[model samples]
Each structure stands twice: as C-alpha cells, then as structure tokens.
Target: MSRQIIKDFVYYFSKPLPFNLLRKLTGENFIFPFYHLVADNTPIHIKNLYPAISVEHFKNDLEFLLKNYHPATINDVLAFVENGKKSEKPLFFLSFDDGMRECYDVIFPILKQKGLQSAFFINPAFVDNKTLFYKHKISLIIEALKVTKENFLVSELMVFLDIFSANNKQIIETISRFKYSDTSKIDKIGKILKIDFESYLKKEKPYLTLSQVLEMQDNGFIIGSHSNDHPKFREISEFEMQNQLGQSFNYLNKNIHPQILSFAFPFSDINVPFSFFQFLDTKIKIELSFGTSGIKKDVLPKHIHRVPMEDNLKNATRIIRSEYAYFLLKSIFRKNTINRQ
Candidate 1:
C-alpha cells in the first residue's frame, strides 16, 4: 500500500540474502510494507552514498550468481535476436563506470565467479593506476564557486582537477557567476584552463589495462566507453560532445573491439533531452545505455538506470516500492495544492 515495500525490495536485491531463504528463516518476506525508500544524496555521491560491503559479502553474491544465474557474451546475447524479436526478459545488463580499480580488484572476482557478464565503462583519460586527484580538487573548487547547492557533473571532479589546480580553482571561483555560455567568456576560461591534458591523465589509475579490460571481455564483460576526460555531455556543445564521444569510441576500438555498440552519457541527468538521445539512437544500435533515473516505461529510449549496491544496505525501504513512495512523500512535504486535489 505504501512505498516502503519497494525500498525494502531494492535493499534486498543488493544483498546475498536469498529471498526464499529469508522467507523460510522467517515466515514474513518483508518487514516494511508501507515505508518508501529514497536513495539518499545527489548523483555527486554516487558510490559513497551506498553502504560499503566487505570482501566476503561481495564474494558470496558472486558465488550465488555463478551457481544460479545465466550469463552470456555480446554474441550470445544478440543470439536472442530473430530477424526482429525482443527477448522475454528485458536484457539483464550489469555495467560499472569510472573503472574504479576496485571494480578491477573487487567487482571482477564476483563477475568472474558467476561468469555473469557486464559492461565496464572507463574514461580513457584516467587510465593511470592512481587516484584522479584533479576530480576531487575541482569539486572543492566548484563548491566554492557555486551560489547554490547544485547538482554536479560528478565524475569529472577528479578528472578536471588533473589539469586545473588550486591556481585555476581560484579563478573559477571568482568568475563563476559570470555567464559561462558566452563565447568570449568560454574562450577566456578555456585559455586559462588549458593544460597538457594527456600529461595529467598519467597521474590517475589507468582504467583496466588493455589486458585487464580484455580479460573481462574474455570473461564476457562488455567493455564500453565513458568519453575522453569524462565531462558531462549535457553541459557541453554539440561539437564538444562529438569530439568526446568520437575519441572515446575511436580509442577503445583501436585497443580492443569489445562492442563499440553501447554508449552511456557522462554524468547522466533528466535534463539530457530526448532529441539529444535521438542523436545517439539513430546512429548506432546501442543495445543498452545508463543514466540516473530509475527504470520505467516512460523513460524508455533512455533505457538503463543504475542504483548502487550500498543504498540497499543503508535503507531496507529501497527494495519495497520505496521509489514510488519517495515521490509521494516528497510531494506531500512540499505543501502543494496537489495534495488537496
């Protein structure tokens, strides 16, 4: 009757707890039937918002997936294609972005155990084997510049910082209120911000090496592109977007031809227009894509929506229809006339 049911269901999805086993353990399948779970924080806190899992728990899930689930390669999945037929189950795709080395160290093992395939979206820019310190620095800089507690193109924080240092942050903070859309202003900003982008890339962790990414491919994980420098696509111009998208796909294809067929918008948001996406859809049969919204019928064509594993742990409500509930509760909190209507 309420949203908590879904939130609880989401939390449950992330856990290794077998829903059947939990039901057997306790006659009750869910404890929160009315509560709705809202995944906390903006997308800026994507990974950190989720609760942390121990290596052991991560391993258990892998063991379960391997023993129970069905996985396939791109070729194998496309086999579901007839001259033109969609599968019964919507494609079950698992993808990770940013190439967090932890994904390499942490997620790969679980994926391997199940032989459950997924996509690993990596920025060609951050393929070095270290932290993208620039991302963190730019975030602090942006915070200083921002007049409001606005949403961020989160993934770029460290990547941007690689080139723009405190010296640059100081300038951005000073002039941020000016209209960044003006050509002259943008030129000034670009000139001031310019650096040897390639040189700075060497400081961070290089995404899965050609070998590590290829191993995922061999193991059946689809390796995909997340754009060069990983800037938010929505904020940039059509020209900039093309360069970012073109270079990412071009480079990955050159290194490993792991299905250049899929693309994910960088720092996804509802603001990315349907027409903008129509641009991508018309060009490639990008079988799947990822973004910030929860998966729903209306949002189709935007296709893939992702939630982190941590939200499942912190809020039992995430699994039990919490998303629907979160909207309702938020609406009520807003003191709108719709409540009376």
Candidate 2:
C-alpha cells in the first residue's frame, strides 16, 4: 500500500478509537506544528513549486487544533525546557516559517480571532524585502519563461552554473542547487531572462516588512529568527552557522525586543553539527529552536520538533493522531524512533 494510504488509514482509524484509548492509557505529550505560508490560493508565479494553504483550510486546521489540544507559545516551551514545567493538558505550539507576507495578512487575523499565539520565524535578509530567496527567484524566472518562452542558450546556463544537464528538469535541479551560497548567480540568470527579482520585491512585496513584524509583535505574536539567509544547516560551515545565528538574533533583538530569543532551522536539522546547539545554549542564550521533522525529539530539549501541517490531505488533529499512532506502533517494535537525536 502507498504510504499516504497507510497514513490516511492510520489517521482515520486513530481519530475515532485507538488515539483516544492511547491518550487515556499513556497520557499526552507536547507537539509543535509548523507551516510555511497560508494564502487563499497559490500565486501563479510560484504555483508550480510551493504549496499554500487556502484561508478556509487554514481556519479549519486551527479550529481542529483548538478543539483537541491546548495552544502554546514559544515562551511556554522555553519555560518547559528551563524548569521542566509543562501544561496539564495536551499542548501544541503553532509556528510559521520563512517570514512570508501572507502571515501578516491572512494568518494574523485568523490567529487574533482565535485568541491564540504563534511564532513567526523569519530570515533577517527577507524582512523589508531586502532580498529574495533564490528558490522564489527560480519560480519567478520559470513563470516568466513560461509566459515569454525566452530562448536563452541552455548550454551557457549549464556552463555558468557548472551543471551537466540539458533538460527542463535538469535546469530546475541546477537552480535548486544554488539555494543559499550562490543565489546572486541565480539572480543574474533570472536577470538574463529579463526577470528582475528586485523589481518583483518592490512591486509584489513577497516578504514581511519591518513595520508589519513590529505590529504583529505588538498584537501578541512572537517573532523568531529563522536565519540571516535561509540555508540548509548541514551545508554551512560552523563559522557561517555562528554568523547566521548571531546576525539573525541581533536583528530581532534590535528591532523586536522579544522577551526570549527563539530560532527555527531554515531546513531540517539533519546534518547540523552538535556544536551549534552548544553555542546556542552556552553563548547565545537561545530559549528555543525548532525543526520540521514531525513529532520527533531532539538532542537538546529546547530544540523542539514540529510537524509540517501544509499538506492539504491532513488536518491538524489528523496529523497529531498519525504521529501518535505511528509512534505507538514503532514503540511496540522496541523502536524509540521519535526521540532520535
């Protein structure tokens, strides 16, 4: 059977019976769930690449979570790590990543209406539309090329990017490789295709602005740093990792004055060095950090794992139930997989 079918089966079956029984028998634990963007519909320019949650579906997920779990903030998790204090009820913290502007528009209103709190983890470079992520640029260029069918020398692009591919899929694969370190080159390629990223930033305003972030903070939303630039943590050097941590936190400290310093890894923390957490704990005073690895435990208690809730097939409660069911099954096999460091 396909994994989705299995997960769906687990989701449905556990939702009605096994989940309730398991929770009553074993008790409930904390869950951290996250999303990237929540928009009414995916924008034409980036629809091919990223998935966005419709506002209606987002409301549904929130409503589901509110019904089954106690909503939490980063501050609450921070206190839990510091003093071993946890809520008596089943708790879940909601967070959004990459500092997308939609969080300000669609997400904030919904959160406010529900009287719940969430953390917005933003890249320092993206605030105020200073620069665009290369992944977004790739989509914009692809969209422009699809419209104009701009015929540039594919060979030249391959040579410039040092990639060995001749197909459209290869071209996208090559572009994805230039994520953090060499985005300027990607921007140059986009410019060659007559797709101006800066102009898009000026006009589209795809990212959160400083003032918008400040207003959200004032309205009881938590602002946490994702990074200075969103890069896969495993791909960067220790020095670069430290710099990302320092610069991002410093920017938030200077502007937001958040009570506690919190950060979420740009991508999954699969290959991140163990030393990085040491720096965060000892030198940086990081209260909380997050990863999107879905119902797992981290080496550091303060480093929380959040399930990605952007998948449309699963609602928040369904995702939680799946996690519990999967974890329970694994536990029966003498596998403590969820707490893998």
Residue-wise lDDT of candidate 1 within 69-155, one digit each (tens)?
A: 344455544443321223333233456776655667667886677665667787776555433423433433343344333224222
Any runs in candidate 1 off by more than 4 Å, and if so which?
1-53, 60-92, 129-134, 138-206, 298-302, 312-341
Worst 10 contiguous positions by lDDT, candidate 1: 29-38
At residue 150, give the lDDT of candidate 2.
38
The TM-scores, one per candidate, come to 0.56, 0.88
Clashing pairs in 2: none
Against the reference, the lDDT scores of all candidates come to 0.47, 0.76
Off by over 4 Å in 2: 1-18, 22-28, 44-46, 73-75, 83-87, 153-165, 333-341
Given candidate 1, what's the lDDT at residue 208?
52
Clash count of each predicted structure: 43, 0
What are the per-residue Cα lDDT tens digits for candidate 2 across 1-341? 86456666766666667555755543446778889888877865456566787887788887777777788766667666775534466777889999989999888988888878889999989999999876788777666545654345555666776667466567766665666777778778876666777788999898899999999999988898898988888888989999998999889889889866888998888777778888988988888888887765454767777888866546666777787776665566745333433
Give the Å shift of residue 135 in candidate 1: 2.9
